[model samples]
Target: MTLPLFPLNTVLFPGCRLDLQIFEARYVDMIGRCMKTDSGFGVVAIVEGDEVGSAPGEFARTGCEARIRDWQQRPNGMLGIRVEGGRRFRVSSAQVQPDQLTVAEVEWLDDQPEKPLTVEHDDLATLLGALSLHPMVASLEMGGEVKGQQDLACQLAYLLPFGLAQKQVLLEMDDPTVRLARIQVLLEQLQGDLTA
Candidate 1:
């Protein structure tokens, strides 16, 4: 299916939330149309270039669908919106519009069936909870809660300050179990780095 794409430097995971400060005319119009039709826009991670001005040179093929949850006009006269990550998708083709919005034809990805969080997930859960207390995270409805393997994985993946490449790997992973295992390794690596 074809989707209006918003390329950003950040990665958003399913079930997580992201806040956007949109001032560009292309995006403002895109968001308005999405809200009007009660649809969603695809958010891709920018692999090169910047979020503002012209098109980013490259973006991850895998991305998330951002559903508008709340929106308001900021004091600075820009649009501030909160969006919830819904489905995952892979962009097969992309086209840039005259206004600079990148539109893509994408294929939706399915999440593995829910898997309950286990003992192995405890440490990650603790870390996720702590991050949720940050003002930016707390302001949103998500980036918290370790309800299941999928939730824990997605939430943690989105919350961690991992660089774009690592984030893209997590987004491309379809198996919650494998993703959880990888996260476990990353968390340990992070812990080791901190202690050393």
Candidate 2:
């Protein structure tokens, strides 16, 4: 499928919500067209270069589809839109238009069948519960209940202070169980560093 790309410094995982402020002419036009057609744009994490300037020099090959959930003209004069992440996709090829917008041919990544949370996931679920209570997370209004392993993994990967590269790795993984296990190890490392 062909998708207009929004390369950013952050990674967006499926089933998560991200609020974006669109100011650039290229993106503003892109978002308008998406909303009109009830289509979505691909959001890829930038590996190099800035979000507001020329097209990013490099970005991850994998990205999430962003479907706009809400939009309004912000008091700051930018278009504020709330988007929910949809499918995962791998970019096969991309090209920059004269307007500097990157469009890509991508293949949707297959999602693993949903698996219920097991005993081992209890700790991770608890941690997510605590994180959800924070003012910032609460403001996103991400529901309090985790539906399954994929839900648990994606939410944690999106909310935690994991590095961009780490989050991107989690996003690309096809197995929810493996993603959760990796997150557990990363969490341990994060705690260890905090104490050291």
Candidate 3:
């Protein structure tokens, strides 16, 4: 399917929430079109270049589909929108339009069947629960409970301070078990760094 791409410096995961401020003409127009059509857009992580003015130098082929949930016009003269991440997709090809909007032909990633959280995931789930208490995380409204392995993995991966490339790896993984394992390793590395 063809998708309009929004290349940013961050990665989005399914079942996660992201609030975006829209001001640039290209993106404002894109958001308007998406809202009007009740369609979603692809949010790819920028491997290089800035988020504003001109197309990104390069971006990860894998990304999440962003569905608009709420929108408002801010007093600061910008459009504010809350979006929920829907599905993962890989861009096959992309090009910049005259308006500098990036559009791509993308293939949706296969959905992994939902798996219940194993006992091994309890610590990670607890970590996510603790994360939810922070004011900033609370503001994202990521929801109250972990539903399954995919949900848990996505929420933690989205909220953590992991690098863009690391998050992109998590986004591209199709197996919840493997994704959670990778997250565990990353968390251990983080803990090691902290202790050192």
**Ten residues in a row with the worst lDDT in model 1?**
138-147
lDDT by residue (1-196, candidate 3, tens digit) is 9999999989999999999999999999999999999999999999989999999999999999999999999999999999999999999999999999999999999978899988888899989989999988899987469889999999999999998899999999999999999999999999999999
Better of 1 and 2 by TM-score: 2
Q: Distance from true position, residue 193, model 3, in Å?
A: 0.5
Better of 1 and 3 by TM-score: 3
Count of backbone clashes, every candidate in sequence: 0, 0, 0
Off by over 4 Å in 3: none
Task: Report the error of model 1 at residue 96, Å.
Answer: 0.7
Q: Would you estimate the TM-scores of all the predictions?
A: 0.95, 0.99, 0.98
Indicate which candidate wins on lDDT: 2
| Model 2 pairs in collision | none
